[model samples]
Target chain A: MAKLKNPRGLEDSQVMKMSYWKILSILLLVYTVTGGFLMEVPRLAIVNETIRSLYFHVPMWFGMVVMFLTSTLYAVRYLKKPGAYFDIISVEFANTGLIFGFLGIVTGMIWANYTWGTPWHGDPKQNGAAVALLIYCAYFVLRGSLENSEQRARLSAVYNIFAFAAMIPLIFIIPRLTSSMHPGSGGNPGFNTYDLDRNMRMVFYPAVIGWILLGVWIATVRIRLRNIEDKILELEYEKNH
Target chain B: MKRIISIAASLGITFTGYAQEPEMADGMRSEGKIYVVVAILAVILFGLVAYLISIDRKVTKLEQRLNDGKPR
Candidate 1:
């Protein structure tokens, strides 16, 4: 690892641009918020009114997985480079992903409660999602326990990779191996089963993209705030020592 | 404030009297109640996004102050 005299990590002109994530976020919000509520959906049993939650709730998992994958990619980069830039990015992505995952679980529980007569039914998919969240929760706890920056980054990066590994089987494979209340798993009527109705597909696809882009926007803001914090810490250290 | 509260209480009770489980509109152009749901969702989403934008602006201001090395 190269020791840098300057610890501040803001140098990219492209990142400082105003039109990048902001405009995209606004456009996506406009499309999603309008289309999600207005779009038509099939009247499925039990989930009649709540089928609209697909646009709002189900997309949260899509956003979470996309953000987590982005975080894992940054973790791999941090392992290779050992830079604060990559570490900042890795942590922010993880943070955003965790928020999305938390929302997903809450929405899913609410949806389940109304439909299945319980908030949690020990379904394979629900259990798998809970475990995946626990793994990431442990990652944050691990980071909080460490004081040294490099050691924290290194250890967290390794744990993040392992967390991602556990996430895949928990979310994808286990759900398929057993009965699940979640759609698209274990013979349930799903997007794949019907490929989604025409109107539903139009809004659903945009909703997923919109939520994922919103997650990215949040992550970038967090990264910027963290960068500012890092700069302040470095300046303070220089002034005192 | 008392009047408003009593009015709100009566409205809530009146709505609950006819309410069914998982109330939903038939389609977009059918009943107008779907528009009410749509409006509520729009308000919630807009409020959330706008709050986030406000935080972003505050952070950007702080970042600018740091870059300029000014207390202001």
Candidate 2:
């Protein structure tokens, strides 16, 4: 039998040429070391020195947002093309996004503990973030419980649309309406000002980009693996039959 | 034991004096800063974990498929 070519035509691509895991590791190492050193610097620190957490917390939320946005894109593609690959990519992105969302909440809680004198202050931002995360978690559970691939994909795609729509209000609008000890709320205008100085921005912006790239790199690896697994499963079923 | 007792006594006196002074009562504002740094690091760690897990699941699926195709 002739060898089947990669359907996505990525097998020979430059992106597939390099080891994603190694590149991701190197980027993570650099981010950690540089961020750590910058945080330790005496003068650059803010909010009684708790502002250093911004590097970690803000980036996770940014990464999560990126993942969810990617998921939404794939969901749209799935609706149009009805391909398995798109569904897989969408679910994979959602899984990664949820992990980042949970981290953002944890880090925010820790920051609040020190600055606001408690881990949780019933802040609007906190509550809204929690609700958004829970919605995505439910999406995953719903997908898992379903047995049929086509049904799972269609249902998940529809749910993803709704989840993404709700996310806008939960993450951006609601936080703005109510009181939040968090920087950008309660009539006290958040990070829009020079809250993050030029020096902070130098590291902060790169951290966001790096983390998002890292997220994509991971999702690609996952998609590739899923393809391989499907091929093997097909072979096995053929042999059995 | 005697030296330990003396040290404890000195520390108590120092803390009492610090508490009495309004300025010193604030303790080093540096603690708050450290907390912030820790919180940020925790978030980054979570993102890292998310990335790793996504990759791991894919690899596992691939490996399982490869194994399933082999002859018994």
lDDT value for model 1: 0.80
Interface RMSD of each: 11.8, 12.6
Clashing pairs in 1: none
Docking class of 1: incorrect
Q: Which stretches of candidate 2 lie over 4 Å from their true place?
A: A1-25, A28-32, A39-46, A187-196, B1-72
Best by lDDT: 1
lDDT of 2 by residue, A92-134 (tens): 8988899889999999988888656688888888898999999
**Pick by DockQ: which candidate is best?**
1
Provide the TM-score of chain B versus the true chain B for each model in turn: 0.59, 0.49
The residue ranges of model 1 lying beyond 4 angstroms of the native Cα positions read: A1-17, A187-190, B1-24, B27-31
True contacts kept of each: 0.28, 0.12
Tens digit per residue, CA lDDT, model 1, A141-191: 999999999999999999999999999889888887776657777644355
CAPRI grade, predicted model 2: incorrect
Using TM-score as the measure, which candidate wins? Answer: 1
Candidate 1 lDDT by residue in tens digits, B17-60: 66543235655448666678668878888888888877776677
**Per-candidate RMSD, Å:** 10.5, 10.6
When only chain A is evaluated, what TM-score does every model earn? 0.89, 0.84
